[model samples]
Target chain A: MTIATATMTSKQRMLAALDGRLPDRLPVTTHHLMPYFLDKYMNGITDQAFFDYFDMDAYVWTVPHRHDPSQGEYPDPEQGEIGFLESRRVSTDDWRVYWEKLPGYEYQTVRYRFVTPKGTLSMVIQSNEHTAWVAEYLIKNKRDIDLLGEYMTAPKCDVEAVNRTAEEFGERGLVRGHICCFDVFGQPGCWQDAACLMKVEDLIYATYDDPEWVHELLKILQRRKMIYIQSLQGARFDIHELGGGSASSTVISPKIFEKFVAPYDKELIAAAHHAGQRITYHTCGGMMPLLELIADMGPDAMETFTPPGMGADVNLAEAKRRIGDRVCMIGGFDQFHYLIDCAPEDTRAEVRRCFEEAGANGRYILSPSDHFFDADPELIRAFADEARRCSYR
Target chain B: MTDLEDLRQSIIEGDMKSTTSLVESALADGLEPGTILNDGMIAAMTEVGRRFEEGEYFVPEMLIAARAMQAGLKILKPKLVDSGTKPLGTVAIGTVKGDLHDIGKSLVAMMLEGAGFEIMDLGVDVPPEKFVEAIRGGAQVIAMSALLTTTMPNMRATVEAVKQAGLRDQSVIVIGGAPVTQAYANEIGADAYAPDASAAVRVTRSLIS
Candidate 1:
């Protein structure tokens, strides 16, 4: 019997898809909503169309906070640049939310750059809308590390606010959340946090010059994230992304990953799962060397199966055959060459190739291997349109 | 007698303190500055590069080894200059515009410095015009790095701008990064492509030699 035609919220569809259940069709999701799309497409398209255009499940993120409702300039803050957003100044006893609005959408960049006895640190503004995340400082020296460890506060997440937002999104779409990441910086987990808090350059040096100190810093960052994940209990989320792939395999040797990355991330993943969140590990670059290791750590899904041509050397078919049963695969589209200036037919063919390789086990999400900065808008429609055609059901 | 072998071991073990001490001792013991650099320091770094390529060592190992080599060079550079040791060539390096990523470029710069080339790092988010300025400043080879594909085209643009300014032949262009390829280098009319920092040094040495 044919199912009755009815509207499903993006949250409902996405959770169903994550559970390996069929939606009306394939659920196409992006890592982030691009500002370029929002600025150009002003046709009264609601945020839901951000996913609806692709016919994919929509995921809404709401980062909540309770701060003092007052207006004043932050004298000295922790992490990011202050006065650049809509921030109200509060006494030390009160809390505040800092936000900066740009044209379009329900999102704004919220940040408060803090100055401490050690040094300065900043927090990325979390919102329902997509804002560009940028790094304000990279750990450049040992002094910077000491300062970060001493000064940077583990972010205070408003779980009550998040629960309310999730309840609001109930059955409409999926509510997805991640560990509040450092402002326009690296990934949210410990290793990436360390990489961001400390510049990749300085971190490399510290690995040899003072490994013990590095371990301590990573532990602090890891513990902070664990606390955040634990706090995520009972919150509505489909899957939370935790790792950046740059350090996973090709960027650094597996030895470094073993010493610096794997142990901590593996720990975080376990904690997140214990807290009832499905984990999606995002390795944007060459992850072939560490795929088995990453898979063994047991994230529910993995993304951006980069091809060797793109400097991420995963053969999609090989990756699927090897670990397809173990974890859900996301992102196999080639956005670099295929999306920009390629023929529409070529785009269709690429989509078919991804489907054939990753679509076999009913455990893949077809998406661009990573975010595309510039693309022909028609190319995007071809991607979404083709994905719609290749439904598993 | 602090000899080449001892210095080589110092570098190989990444004994920066020893490497520094050995270089001074070698200079005091009347070893020729060029001999110490080529036979001792350079030889050790070349082995480090080989071990890195062979996967016997990783980035941390390579970084420390490079750091140790730098410590040795700090002693050797002034002596070589006083003794009139000419470098292989001059290199100007930078990340392409719109790309702020620089670990790759900085590593390439360090490796080039280790290989005895005078290097001018143009820093990140470098426009094509900055490359032109670097070339006019007497850079013999221009090396461009880009971590993002969106910025990779700037390498080609920089090369074309150099040609337009009539400076292409005077400076060889080399490009390398996570996103760049030898094929990309050829397509963009670059003179060379190095897959990694160690190879970057090798290619730079060959171009100048």
Candidate 2:
């Protein structure tokens, strides 16, 4: 195959790689445009501005969730600026929602309680300027899983809302979203979603202490996700994210992934394909061991090929050799060190390395291994410039 | 199988019910608590660690085996104390200040507990003063974890606080997490750097020894 002489737009570049064809140049992008990074580092520039400043391909993430009116779902009243398609309140008279602000912390702490006719479930999330984390998981006890099954509202795709955003976005970028998980707290994979509800440690322990219970809980979560996937028919998303860090080999073994992660996600991927949307399995850690399994899940793309320097065991050349033909490879550059502390020349070299390895195949998009809270704008400029220079011949 | 072998097998299989019952039965049969713990609980955890290192077991497997061992240990703890037994060592573990991630820290704590070390887990977003306090309170080893690159400098701050508090020699400092490395550990003056939970246990044991 010979390199094209003509240049492609950012959308064309990304869509070309997603379709397993080489664009005029490498499609270079970053994973997330963190609000904190924008506010602190770039003086609150818009995401489009950041992409334009760096001259990189942009990914516009717009998550539009639909709720059943019969289920008494309503939009959250106190949604913030960063809240894109924030979770809706599903509890009616039978299930009440309550909130409280915990006192005394550097960050804001909010505890949300869901009072059900059966029982009550609560989750404590702590948020600083950067992001939020679950201090206390939602599913405190096994019975809470039953409460979620009974009371939780299943989110559907708001096809009109998504189409409007896609129209506004025009040909600027790819419109990305994810399949719905649980409300307020969830992951794309079934086991990973369960882990968020129950803390990861508790869930892992539960897998051994009560394997049957674990399987039952995973199935419950899987059913909820299937409902959401079924609702995705005709949504105008370019690609949907379908996995999380928990399924990565750095977190779980390939054995656990095959047993717990693959089966449910495979079904979800098939559902997504039926809905006329492409899926990308987002594993932000080690992918070396489970590359084939992730490819077998039938996602159009795979991402965050974390390098060993970031405490993950990913080799981009080997990953490209093993599974690049099967799926479009998305991330491999080491932004943790190279994008922040290194020289611009060094950053360019790393970009070239990723291109040489994963870019030879027509199905690769050069991206940071994951989100970077801090990076030199000059280095980012060099990165994009180097990626643009990496043309096929 | 003999009762001890049965107990070990239960723990290895992550059968908490059988492991706890077998421990109680062994104790009722006048078996030595130390022998039961060493031969059954610790031995099973050791095998789990070996399997984890060999990639035969994963995080879920290790976590379940640890849970089974904890259940058996609950039954054997008071007996071991009454029989004048002591833990291998005391280690203080926590995620550093400004970092809220704790999966790695919790894994290290659980693994150290499985290896017979008493762990004082100062949960996420722990400050430098907390490490000094843990050291002053007789924690012989300090294990710090941070998942974010921005929060990684806190490891150096924690090590400096240990030195400034004159507890540097009294406690061995170890660090691990996604962005932490052996070179970073050395740069931060940490005594050791563990790549994962299993390695954390081994490093903690060697440090305390």
Candidate 3:
């Protein structure tokens, strides 16, 4: 009933669906075009070209940020070219990094020491060409968080920089960024950022063993993210994503989500709206249990509804029936099966299936269930082509 | 009798302080270490697993409960050793090479340890040769996990390396993680595929037994 008669630009289509309205067709896009995919398969095509090649509804991401220079902050001198989602190491005199490349490891392992006045906090990390993960967490001791909360510099959003990019890009695609994260490696959501600093198992145990300490840690992270959100007076972002997979039901219980995840993020979601921006709560794991819970947070949209086959529990039809009316739905196609080692027909069928189930009353953007590191280009074309043909009329 | 029941409830509720206290009390009351373990810790993990499979519990709950069980087990382990108790089997577990996602692998290791298996945890980003080393060092089973399809290939590579090392028959290989499936297990020629950590305990028991 909300479908328009004519075709709309990607921005207009996304904005319309984001408002719970339908456009001429489904708004199809992929999340994070992996550099590995672009380098290996497409001869290092630009991310925008990846969108054009598949004809997807594109989102141009921008994160222009700065650190406090008065604190002797500068980019790490010894660091090399930054990879995806990595900013230059924001170094200060109190927060210096000493990296030692350890011998004998399967992947690239580097042990980092952040020297500060209270003492030193160290974390080891490993990375292949594709992704990175924390090996040794920074907050080793219970009170190590004090070093971070006291010394860590929160990145400032360059409002003029964001506004300039939006002006230049015009309507080619929607401009986006996320709530600022913890310094070294973190997600936007407060609890998820805490999970990154502490191992998830330890964090979950703390939620039971020392709930007050868990709150203390989450509060510090929540306050840092709030500093970034409050600075965004007019950033011109089409939608900013909040939440992460650690809060998903597959990883944590509903009780924990209600107790730890929802309260902190609910306030941020409101603050983002107050800044004249739209927010999409991104939980790229089992969303079935937290559907109504996340929806009640009042995000403008929600996403990455990972299916059960991918080891998360998302019943797309049931999800639409439950919260489809409340928020814009994005991402439900299983890229693992349909976009890799499958026929183009399979990909097209999945696009149609998502359209039938969640796209019926509109406000649904058909995307891959979540991010994928490997997939076929032909299947991707079929994915986009079929999505374009899925008319709401 | 009441103390053991309280110990079980503590473990089920993931009460670390009370689980250790109850185990200590049960030991002081002249209960056998094996009896305390079987009646208190393992029984509680069994209920935790049941609740996990039935959707009444989740990863965090399972983790907290496992922590409680481990806490109780720590109190019982020395006494159990003095009483000449033997673990069910030896399990060598890790997240496969190029995959640093270890939370799921850690859960499986803890669950297997709770099930009375002696575990040699190889940690994350583990190469196939380390698993081979564990087997040659007399680990009875090799369990590997990977959370990404990019890294899932390492599972098969590990299976191949075990065959190459001429120790394929010495160890039973169990593969699992987010992107892993039963078909992938079969494709990679692994002995078993467990959907989650709770199922992993049963699968590990069935395979080793």
Candidate 4:
């Protein structure tokens, strides 16, 4: 194997891998660092410093969005801080958001209402100190999709704001964002967003029972996401993520994925490419069956190659052999076992195993499959230090 | 197809409309409710579980099949009660404290019910006391689920609560979800661990036997 001669920055390494080119070393980073882990383990370190602390390459998450006032869209009056994969909620008079705290049985539950000119759609969300989930989905009735299509405002990309951060973050990390989803509760991809609106079980059943309605729902969601994609023409995102766990093969069958998931997301990936942005389809569950199918959708990368121990099916070497040459591979480390409650020797060996397997080639980033709620700081440090030593030289 | 054959086929294919109609027709034909349940809907669920284990069906297919079983059961439940057909056992199920995920747990509950177990769905974010209460209420099994690693420890806490409540020996504790494993179940002193909804029935049955 030829070693890369030039040493590069984290940003350079990530960009190199994204293009399926060799970097100086295996690019090592992680998916989202959970706040619970950070606060409990690392004394609440800043996200950037958490990467720097381990001396591994960092990934800076940024998605700046603006309002198209000409379309009568302004920032929602009641919305607070924008969060991960979230654009600022753009509200028009016809469509407004109002949330009220509800007494939950054990956690904090809140109901968000979308007051639209046509009608109001409400969803309930519940959360604890660690994370949140949809207690009640927004689309209660079949006709709710029509209300969203007619009244919901699309959030636009704040191109200048995103580029400004990218300029300042030069050589530090890659800028990332995602396509907007359904209002109140949703994920990036069409079927996934639909899953959040309704239930994944219902969505899957809809594919078999009422496929035409499923298609209509997907079309409505894809239309809103298309507006966001069109607005991303000049944003400097290194990669935008699509897909969620609901689309994972672990959750649905290959037949369902091909019929309900692929058709909509493949078009979005193509649109994203046309808008000059790289797309990475993130499936954080059993991916063994869908690797080739996902690669066929034309994403620049695919990620979170979880292993069987984490309740997903991924054989790193097999995955690398299948799609490694086509797209950059990200996240194969079994963090649940190796990142905590294991000897440092075992942790280093895992890092080496990933390097020897998927990382032997140029386009693999060593990362955990997904967010971990708890981990030993020393093991995390060992994880990063060992990865940096996996140099191409 | 004959009424019984159509009843089995509709449920296996997850065709709820056909399943309910065939079940109604079978009842109209004077078939016993228990016969329709055990030989028809429940038999289809057993095949559904087998197909899930063999990878011929996935979560969606299994869930859809479970929905069909439930619909047919809804029609047969009254007749079964009138005839005094007993269930397999009673199971107390919940999603544990601090975790709110419901789908996987609900599937397991449905699958158990399809297998003829009476389910006490304790709902999400259930505390240890609630599980203990369910056990005191004569639940033969305790099934818990947690989607996040943060909430997984609640399984251990719930087990300990059962032990402390002096109901541990009488209850079979089973655990599962995205991050759950056999090792985790063993570590938490749970009676069994099910990797998926299909395995849950097998494990629960093995433990009960």
Give me the candidate number with maximum DockQ.
Answer: 4
Per residue, candidate 3 scores C-alpha lDDT tens digits across B3-87 of 7889989989888898998888898889999888887788888899999999999988889888889988988899999999989
Candidate 3: lDDT over CA atoms? 0.86
Model 1, residue A137: distance off in Å is 2.8
Candidate with the greatest lDDT versus the true structure: 4
Candidate 4 residues B1-209, lDDT tens each?
Answer: 24687888899999999998998888888998999999998899999999988989888889899999999899999999999998888999999988877888999999999998999999988999999999999899999998878889999999999999899989999999988999999998998899889999988878877
Highest-scoring model, TM-score: 4
lDDT of 1 by residue, B130-156 (tens): 999998999999999987776788999
lDDT of 1 by residue, A1-393 (tens): 222343445555455556666555555666665654445553535566666665555667554422322432232243243322212122232222233444552345455444554455455433332233333454544555565554443443556777887777666666666665553454665777777665676777777778898898888778757766777777667677778745756556676777888888888889888988888888877676677877887788888798766666778999998888888888878877677768999988898888888877467787788766566667778877777676545
TM-score for each model: 0.83, 0.93, 0.94, 0.96
> With candidate 2 superimposed using the best TM-score fit, by how many Å does residue A114's alpha carbon deviate from the native?
2.7
- Candidate 2 lDDT tens digits, B124-176: 89999999999999899999999988899999999999999998999999899
- Higher-lDDT candidate of 1 and 4: 4
For model 4, residues A1-393, the per-residue Cα lDDT tens digits are 233444899999988999988888888898988877889988988889898888878877776768888988889889897764456788999999999998735678889999988789999987777877898888788888888889888888899998998898888888877778765667888888888888787788788888999999999888888888988998888898898878887788888889888999999999999999999999988798899999999999999899888889899999999999999999999998999999998988999899888986688989999888888989988888788778876
Taking the true A–B contacts (Cα pairs closer than 8 Å), what share appears in each candidate? 0.40, 0.75, 0.72, 0.75
As for candidate 3, its clashing pairs are: none
Rank candidates by TM-score, best first: 4, 3, 2, 1
Candidate 2: where is the Cα deviation over 4 Å?
A1-6, A68-96, A115-119, B1-6, B25-32
